[model samples]
Target: MAFGKSKNRRRQDAAQTKEAVKGAVRSHGPGLLKAILLTGLTCAVVWGGIELRRWALSSPTFLLKETTFSGLQRAAPGELLKLSGLTVGQNLWALDVEMLERTMAAHPWVRTVEVRRHFPSSVSVEVSEHVPAALAVLGDLYLVDEDGEPFKRLQPGDTLDLPLVTGMDREDYLADEAKTRERFRQALEVARAYAATEPTKRERLSEVRMAPEGLVLVLADGTEARLGEGDTDAKLQRLSRVREELRARGLSAGVIHLENRARPGWVAVKLSSPASERSGASQ
Candidate 1:
């Protein structure tokens, strides 16, 4: 009976120790569960971030599929596309807009350029090109803008009824752009004056040759108008008057000199052979 009591006591002790261990585990159960949940959340976030990055980089949605150009006149689309340096299947977000603009604007025809990147796969471009105002006869003919900026070489396809500005050296212009530009401005003024005048006088303008003495106008009828350097407007007015008087009398002059600034009112005219003989025959 004593042995049996001792065995029962040992069983009781074992039961109590098991219960104590269970109680300890239960007390720390919430903290263990929270630690496991935090680790799982951190791992999930890292995995999700990696996947998002991968998707963003390799996704077909962000790839450049189309490129479009607008506001173009003289600029060729193929040349514009070539100059843009943008290619299909390129990354849209990786496009350098500034670099693209610089490259396109470097084209001879492009006056200004605006580059835009559209999301989900497109690029749009705005190109402003230089408009030809005159044909500048340097070594070879060059197209000059209204602002006197020489932009491009004359092509056979370009059939513009613009006036020619001669006696300008390309090297001289390259050496002194400012001086050349000033001369161009004066040439424009002369051209504009002709435009404003009557068609009879305007039709006579063939070429404007810039001379060291002044501006010389070479007419279609082999007549030369010598406009010396003083007041250009005054010179033009005198020229118009002389042209009108001569035209009214059905007379023609070989050289009309307005260079005598000392006698601004008096115009000296050298008659052509036909007109000279006619004047003599009339007198």
Candidate 2:
């Protein structure tokens, strides 16, 4: 009877162990299967992306067939295309748009450039050229853009009848680029102020000389209009009235000093002849 009881106890223990194993498997089986499926999906996606990129780079279907250029004023399409190093037979997907843009931007006249590749067979380039605002005499005469950047040297046949900016040294520019550019911008501001105030006298504007004292506007007839910093528009207006008065009096001025910090509204005018005159601009 004792032997039979021990055998039955062993059988009961084995049966309990089997049930526990089955319960654990039932709890964890679905989660394990889901994890495996997710890993397979992620690997498949990565492989697909790699293959797609490889095919796009090597496929002839994406070969560039045509290139179009727009917003080209001073630059020729052929010239820019050559500079870009983009060929018709090259794969559009393989071409670096940023590199092409950088290369094209190296051209002196290009202020901004955008290069885009159209799907399957074409590319387009858009460029914005710099507008010459004034000529900066920095050792070599350079074309100053509207933003006051001296972009290109004045080449032969580049006939721009703009105001000449003097007293900007190239050595000084190299030493402190920002300060020189600020000076250039200030001179440009004076020119614009003069133009806005006296549009009819635009043609009379010849040179903008940067004197140690301030900015001096040298007219076509060799008259100097001294304009110091600040209140540019007001000073230009005063100058316009003074010029009209002089014209009415059938006289021409040699030097018209409108920038008197001591006596703010007073203008001193020296006649082109032997006689010199000082007058109040406020009147």
Model 1 spans with C-alpha error above 4 angstroms: 1-57, 199-204, 274-283
Report the C-alpha lDDT of model 2 over 1-283, residue by residue, as the tens digit: 9999999999999999999989988999899899999999999999999999999999989999999989998988888888988888999878989999999999999999999889999998989999999999999999999888999999997988899999889998899988988999999989987888777754368899998988999988788999876788888888888888889999899999988998878888988987657566563
Question: What total of clashing residue pairs does each candidate reach?
Answer: 0, 0
**What digit string (tens of lDDT, one per residue) describes model 1 on residues 1-283?**
9999999999999999999999988999889999999999999999999998788778988999988899998777788778877899988867889999998898888999998888989999998888887789879999888888888899998888777888899898999998898888788788778666636644557778888888888777777888877677777777777777788998888888878766766677777854463221110
Q: What TM-score fits each model?
A: 0.72, 0.88
User: Which lDDT value does model 1 have at 229?
Assistant: 77
Off by over 4 Å in 2: 1-20, 201-203, 275-282
Pairs in clash, predicted candidate 1: none
